[model samples]
Target: MSRLDITHERASYQAVFALDVITAAGALIFLGLASKPTFQRIKQRRFTAPNSKNNSARDGPLKTTLGTYLFLWPALLCLFIAYVCRLVSDLLKTAGTINYDDDLGWNGRRAYSTADSGYASNISALTFTTALATIFFTVLLNGGVWIHSSHVQENGTGISTPRTKSRIWNSAIMLAMLGTGLAAWGLGIHARDVSTGSSGPHALLSWSTVLQHHRATRIMYIVHEAIVVAASLSVSIEVLREYATTNRNARDSPERKDLLRFAFAVVPLIWLRDIFILYDVVLLYVDTAGWSATAVDATTLLLVVCRQLANLAILGMVLWGAWRMSRSVALFGRSYYA
Candidate 1:
């Protein structure tokens, strides 16, 4: 190749490589930040007692809020980093005059490269997935906050009322899940067209052709994402209801038991959906070995099958946990009410 060609290739390669490195670094930072407070809280056994009546008096306002916020710092950092990376990538593309057909210059040419295309698509999927995941995760975290706040308020004010705060939070979570699910469905339709025999680029190129192609794999991914979202929403709702009513008195008190049992039951379903997502990513991104083709696929079909079994195991564990919790709740109710 000529010197010009070599220079172009080198520059394009470097930009793509940098993008990947920065993205990975951001993810690691997020993971580290998220885990720090969790580790500390675990060591402290913060959940040992129900929210104390004098929590504010004992811990003070700043200490309580700071501790709670610290756990969420990592997630916030991840969101910030993701937004920055996306903005930077867009800027570079625009400045480099990157074109779908290499119109502008180095930036355009680099953006159109095969590696760049796959990278961009994968990042898009990951970003959307992470956004959806974060919504549900944050809601759960916030639900915990509401639980603590309700407990503290009741203690301080000498007012005890059935806590419907978590219910409101869970309802919001379900709505968010529904919105994300719809988005995922739309993306899935677009992906289906791309995987099939569509002549045009994916939706990033032209939104109109998004649903042109249809593929089973793409459909499967959309379904999987939807299932995970729904399952997560269900788990959150059940947990919230249980937390709200744990202090209530009932003849059988099956409500709390049922809620706990439902949560345990859904965990495996969520796990299964996660496995399918991993499989879909591997199949969609990685090259596979064939009679004449090179590059071995990193993920195996056997591994995917094993993931299904693993999901089943998770489900079994959840069911067992639910049973145990139910039995314990029943015994407690009988002893207390009898």
Candidate 2:
């Protein structure tokens, strides 16, 4: 809105991507080690149970770990969203049908979205894909993790009934996700019609409806993040329960040491990532600051900085997870812990 030196934005993106490459490469190597025949044999032999004292027989062989599947689905979904976003921007640029100052008006409020500019089709498609991907990703990824981790905790600690029913929590999660997706698509349709200079039944969503969409999306994201944190806490409690009961003095065991490391390391990092991301999302909408250029610039700068910091923290978390996996491979060639 304040017409920032686009160069700064470009530089930040480049720097974050460079760090991501390193993180991705490190992760690939860690995953590669996991794929070795020797390690696979060892991993299958190790980590074959519910790590509880009461249920020694609950342990059995799993051909593959849950984390592997959980990570892959979300990654693919995010990649799809990013590709759609890029495609929308590239199509807009290539068509050269609208400039920021004219067609978009001041601060990117599209005063005129012409069909000739590809606003209706391309942007609508991108927005719909983004809505779908984010909704499905959050529901499947976090929901799945919470479910599996809860199962582990329940079986290990023998805590069958938590304070709340899983069904209620799951229903709330789905509702939040659905509301987010619907709001996004609704906002997108509103924008598309606005650009084409038509006031359909959808035009009931005035430009301010966009702000409402932003607010709804933000609130839903916070709720989802909190839900994930609660689920993660459940996992930690399960681990601690084991330590208190069976593995009270088994810190010498690599497996026991690994579990403790995970409770402290990965969980806190996950907490940090979620908090920073939530704050960044809030800062992003601060562009709606309206007339004050200084406020707009300040908010934008903070948003960018916070996002990069969050990205850095995410990479660090993944790198740490990879290192932990490597440690498991070294200590027990067939073990999979990450």
Candidate 3:
């Protein structure tokens, strides 16, 4: 390759790498904030007492508190920033106007040629998909808050109720389903491009031209996502049941146990989703020669995998808390109510 070609390649590589780094850092920051004690306190405030007539015990500790908003706002801010940055990057790529190759070509060749097809259209679709997924996650987070608040109101001050446990289970299931669906849709779009020879945005539309090329693969991707969602939801339900039983007896219970067992049990299932995600990452990298080599497949699968892992860890923590609840409920039994 000529000097101009070398320079162009290096610039492209750098841009892709920068995007990856930013995405990873944003994800880690979000996860760290989510796991803080303030978040835990907010979640704990949802538990309700069984018999208190005043219902004051069931009222969330942070419902109107500034501290609660402080604890939650940072994560949302980080997510918003990350999403906006990603959208900007995608827009830049689709415009095909940024001259990635700065060095003058030996023969005045364009640094990167624009695709014959309208690049912006394909990118718009991808952006829309991502935005939709983000909305789903936001809804899930809000649902969690609602579920926690309801738990506090129903149980009174000292009594732990089973209904709260059910809500947690349902929330986890919904989140898992949403994540799984997004992953599957992404993979389906990826596979459709690979089957056709067209490059860039045009290749994405290739799916419309050849509907049967990779139909089986697309179906499999959808099924895998569904299974992941189902398994995660099942695990969440089990953990909630254990939590309700444990919390109800904590004061009178003598046996102190860790709920980590339930957490560990669900790890394998949650990890399965990550494993599939990794497979997609490897396949995309190998087939497309990394994001810079292909505009249509520029997304970083690793980032998505990391987010899934963080989610699994969060679920595990909930399980651990449930275990402690189980021990308390077992020891105290009827005395917890008294």
- The number of the candidate with the highest TM-score is 2
* TM-scores of the models, in the order given: 0.33, 0.52, 0.32
Candidate 3: stretches off by over 4 Å: 1-82, 97-139, 151-168, 182-186, 189-338
Q: What is each predicted model's overall lDDT from 0 to 1? A: 0.38, 0.41, 0.40
Point out the higher-scoring one by lDDT: 1 or 3. 3
Which model is ahead, 2 or 3, in terms of TM-score?
2
Better of 2 and 3 by lDDT: 2
lDDT of 3 by residue, 162-190 (tens): 35665576556565556655654565456
- Residue 160, candidate 1: Cα error in Å is 5.0
lDDT of 2 by residue, 21-49 (tens): 44345434433433443345455654333
The local distance difference test score of model 1 is 0.38
Q: Which candidate, 1 or 2, would have the higher lDDT against the true structure?
A: 2
TM match of model 1 to true structure: 0.33
